[model samples]
Target: MRKIEFVSCHRLPERSFFFRGKQFPFCARCTGIYVGYAIFIPALWFIKIDIYWALLAILPTTIDGLTQAYFNRESNNFLRFTTGILAGYGLAGLSDFIAYWIVHFFKYLFVN
Candidate 1:
């Protein structure tokens, strides 16, 4: 089954944090991003953010990934995942912040 194959591919060492766990390769932050998005997007449906500002917050991680990909240096998976998680959280926080600002701005413009 596809699930079995996926699990087998990410088998970690016995000492690893995710040793024998279902979610391997992805650390706490990465897991947080995936789980957070599931929760946050619905929240954003009732609230919205400036898309550009959110993108700006996510830019650093994008740059890091692109640079790492294009360069010839061999980096380990851990560093890659760390950067990814940081970027994901940064984007999430930025989205939330922008959404909050937009809501406040609308409240001020309409109510005041």
Candidate 2:
């Protein structure tokens, strides 16, 4: 539980999902994000997505979270989960992009 909490706030019981009356370790949105990562990480090797498009994919989550945090707007679990998936995919793509460039940079610097 501590390790899970290290990665997620796990705050706000209402935002979490429960099974058999046991709460999930992470919130619904976080669960979706992790699920997205699981879906996309393996695909990164075959799918070459541009960082710009990946960043664009993250916009919906950013907007939704900001709106809810600042304006006190209510958000449903479905919306949160969907947006989290998008954000997670985008984040994975961004990480891939950065790692690719860094590796190339080092190869260029050392191999050339």
Candidate 3:
């Protein structure tokens, strides 16, 4: 952004966009990731999508990243953001899965 004071702003200027001559706080991918996680943190409580589904959600992000890294393919911000969102969902779901299993394991061990 114009402010250039924030850490993320400085770190990801190329990845960010300039609308109305104002730079975004983070790159498209980062924005999507943050937004997705923000959405997931709260909504995750209500939704019970399985870990396999979560892996499916994360697939796109991994593919995109791998292709870009190895093939040197160019990409747009919107796509980056989209992949980030998918990754974010996976990240949240995986975290929930781990936490859920851990709690259950302790409960089962201690209770029995």
Candidate 4:
């Protein structure tokens, strides 16, 4: 049997969550990101999230990740998870905002 792993994440055991003695497929940060996606994507259709807010949402994760990578700063699972959630939510919102504007522009050009 082939072992499946999430390619995007290192999936370090120390950074991951365990349930029932089995480690979760994704690390804590990734888990939070997916959870954020689950919670935010559905709301996109109803909420009309703004571009500024979306960009703002992503800042924390960017800073956290960068600091960890370049400055040798260490982050805990809780911090990673929280920042991941913000990043995921921001990404989804930003993508939706861009897509909406593109479609609207095309529709306007073709229809009017």
Candidate 5:
């Protein structure tokens, strides 16, 4: 595995959660992100939205992460997972924003 993949081992095991008999690929927060991306990317077309909606989604995760780092506070796996979901929701919005711009750029190039 790459160094990046191995870095998960460095996280606080007290913060890690397990399922069945095996360890998840990542901790709860990362799992939430994965689940969120899976859900939100496809949801863009069904929902009417702008980038700010995504920013709202990201606020919890950012605050959690920053508070943990800056204040040395401890948070639970559930909060991490929920906040990760928020971040993932925003990530999807960011993707949609990028796609919108890309499509318009191509339109500008070919039609103009």
Candidate 6:
């Protein structure tokens, strides 16, 4: 019975929210990205704001992964996952204000 349940659940669709165990809307990196964004965005908004610094911090992950990917040396899951998380967090922090502005702009442009 347990084996049947595990097999059935494992074969379920990724987008479906009907599985067991940990529940995340997206995968691991996505979860990290969203959570990181929520924590860092507000802190950066109220504290010291430096987009350049954030970019600098995130550049290593970007360049390393991209170059490796381009060269077809992308067998390192750990490296890719780490880089993706860092880049996602950095983008979220740097773009929070821009995201808000865009949403507000769209709201006014589309509504009425």
lDDT of each: 0.56, 0.87, 0.82, 0.89, 0.83, 0.57
Off by more than 4 A, model 5: 1-12
Q: Which has the higher TM-score value, candidate number 2 or candidate number 4?
A: 2
TM-score (C-alpha) between model 6 and the true structure: 0.48
Residue 6 of candidate 2: its Cα lDDT? 69
Arranged by TM-score, best first: 2, 4, 5, 3, 6, 1
Query: What's the TM for model 3?
Result: 0.81
Where is model 3 poorest over a 10-residue stretch in terms of lDDT?
1-10
Model 6: per-residue Cα lDDT at residue 102: 91
Top-lDDT candidate index: 4
The TM-score, computed over Cα atoms with residue i paired to residue i, of candidate 5 is 0.85
lDDT of 3 by residue, 21-85 (tens): 87776788777777788989688889976999889988988888789889998778889899888
Error of 2 at 104 (Å): 0.4
Reference-based TM-score, model 1? 0.46
Poorly placed runs, candidate 6 (over 4 Å): 1-28, 96-112
lDDT of 4 by residue, 1-112 (tens): 5566536888899999889998888888888888889889998988877899999998998898899899999899999899889988998899999999999999999999
Give the TM-score (vs. native) of candidate 4.
0.89
Best by TM-score: 2
Candidate 2, superposed: residue stretches over 4 Å from native:
1-3
* Backbone Cα, N, C clashes tallied per candidate: 0, 0, 0, 0, 0, 0
In candidate 6, what residue range of length 10 has the lowest lDDT sum? 1-10
The list of candidate 3 runs beyond 4 A from truth reads 1-10, 19-22
Question: In candidate 2, what are the lDDT values of residues 1-112, reduced to their tens digit?
Answer: 3545467365578998888998878887888788889989899999977999899988999999899999999898889889989988998999899999999999999999
TM-score per candidate, chains pooled: 0.46, 0.92, 0.81, 0.89, 0.85, 0.48
Using lDDT, rank the candidates from best to worst.
4, 2, 5, 3, 6, 1
